[model samples]
Every structure is written in structure tokens, then in C-alpha cells.
Target: MTELAIGHVTTDCAHAADLAGFYAALLDRSVDPGATEFFATVGRESGAHPVLMFIQVPDRTAGKNSIHLDLHAPDVAAEVARAIGLGAKHVADFAEYGAVWTTLADPEGNLFDIGTGQA
Candidate 1:
């Protein structure tokens, strides 16, 4: 038998370094020093899996991705505001099933969600 685990969540963008930097600032994680303009990663300090990797794709698809990230914050409003300040665009907000979530697009237009409740 073999065991597997998720390692990285990679995104394709026009500028890898820029996208990686934006996420690094948003997550308070540092971009790996060995990063290059074509490829970059913002890694976790305590573990190896779940590193956020960005790769340059000059003609990458523009719009919401099929798989989007979901984030949780103590205060959804404030976090969404902060994400906007970091270059994210607020797309919309939804409330259902006793949970409310805000949709936002990253600089390159990759949509993600943020909510107060567990997703």
C-alpha cells in the first residue's frame, strides 16, 4: 500500500513572483528566497505540505478557477477589506445555510471565498 498527502496548491498567473508576493503578504508568510520570476512559492514554516506555489503562465486563463480557495477569518468583513487592499476585488457575498461568505478575486482574477464559519 502507498500513502499520499497534499503537498502544494499551485496557481498559474501572468507573473509568478507578483502573485506569490500578494499571497505571502495576505497570509503573513514569506516568499521563499530561492524564488524566480517564472516560479515562486510561499512556504509554511512548520510543515512541508500545503505550500502555495505560483508559476508564470503568460496566457493563463482569465476568470474564476474551477477550484477556488476557501479561507476563514475571525472577522470576515475586515479580512475581506484587507484582501482588497492587497489588490483583491470583491466579487459578491452570499448568505445561506446559516453561513455567509464573500467572494473575491485575486490580482489575476482567480476567485476565492472567505467566511467566518468553518467551510
Candidate 2:
């Protein structure tokens, strides 16, 4: 048996609610408001155990993120475009193991990768 399981992934951003809303719309999930206006959660209503949480921070620096999310989609191109429409910026496209993936950054400049569901 696995000794540990993920609880949740927390993202620090300038605007917690806005970041949470962006992910909620992208994932087709909903945001659960936190105790204060500075925090919020995405994917709570999806019945998923590990959700995404957004926390408000004062400063947002510009640099490559040490950690990022990797998402899988049935239609890679369409999903990447949809995320772009939701304010994500396209970084690049890459291929590995005969599969294609796209890199993108959220409004706050957090990086994440999206891949076609292929082996």
C-alpha cells in the first residue's frame, strides 16, 4: 500500500480568488470560498480528494517555477487553446515518447504543462 497520499496543491498568487476562478473554469470545477477573501479553493465540488488551493501573497516574482502542474487532455490542441482563452499564455510545444505536449503559464505567470493522453 502507498504510505502517503496528496492532500492538496496550494498556489501562492497575488489574487487568490481570481487564480482559483481561473483553474475552476479550466477544470470545469467550482471554487469554495475560504474563511477570508484572501483564499479560495478549486475542484472542491468535483469530489476529488486532492484539490487545488489558492492563497493570496503580497509579492509575485518573475522566474521559472520550481514546481508546476502537468495536465492530460484528450485533445491537446483544443485544450491548450481553451486554456489560452482563459488567460494562459502559450510557452512552447514539445514531443516525447511519440506524444505531444504544450507548456503554458497562468495569468500570474505560473507554469504548467498539458499533454495529449497518449503513451
Candidate 3:
């Protein structure tokens, strides 16, 4: 038998409140009240289980991000433009191994890729 289970993923952020809010707006979900400085979860019970945790880290993001999220978009090109207008900047142009994808970074320098379908 094959059983698949892994713990949730959390991203470290400098400000819990600010980063939580950023994710809330980006994900279009309300922030979980249980969220604190050490942790936060978006879409807590909506099946996304996508939690963006904020831990008190001294370092501000500099250079390339070691970890990043890949957000699926209905329209990769349009979403890339929209995200850029919303303060996200293009880190790299569109590229693909088998699907379309674009690399972008948030205002806080967290890197994420937006794409349509599967890559």
C-alpha cells in the first residue's frame, strides 16, 4: 500500500501581521484568528491548507530565495502583469520545461512562480 502524508509548509516572514495580510489578500482568504507571531494559516479550513507562517527571523531576504511557492494562474501572462502592478516584480521572463511559467518576487523579496496548468 502507498500512503502519502507530509506536514504543512510554512514560509518565514519578518512581520507576521503584514505578511499574513499580504497572503490573505493574495489568496483572497481571511486570516486565521489563531495566527500569532510564530505561525499563521490561510484558507485554514477551506481545503487549501496553504499556511504561510511568519517566524521572527533577523534576516531580510537578500539574493535568491532558497524556497518559493508556485501559484497556479488561470492566465499566466495576465496574472504576471497584474502581480507586477500590485508591487511584485518580474525576476525572470516566461520559461517552461513543458508548461508556461514566470518567476516573480513579492514586495518583501519572497520569490514565487505563476503558471497555468501543470509544468
> What TM-score, computed on C-alpha atoms, does each candidate reach?
0.89, 0.87, 0.76
Top candidate when judged by TM-score against the true structure: 1
lDDT of 2 by residue, 12-103 (tens): 89888888888888888788756234888876766676889888878766689888998999898999999999999999999988888999
Q: In model 2, how large is the Cα lDDT of residue 96?
A: 87
If ranked by lDDT, best first, what sequence of candidates would result? 1, 2, 3
Model 2 TM-score is: 0.87
Q: For residues 9-91, what per-residue lDDT tens digits would candidate 1 score against the true structure?
A: 99998888899998898887888887787999888553546999999876877555899888898899999999999999999
In lDDT terms, how accurate is model 2?
0.86
Alpha-carbon deviation at 108 in model 3, angstroms: 1.3
Local distance difference test scores for all models: 0.87, 0.86, 0.73
Worst window of 10 by summed lDDT in candidate 2: 28-37
- Quick one: best lDDT, which candidate? 1
Judged by lDDT relative to the true structure, which candidate is superior, 1 or 2?
1
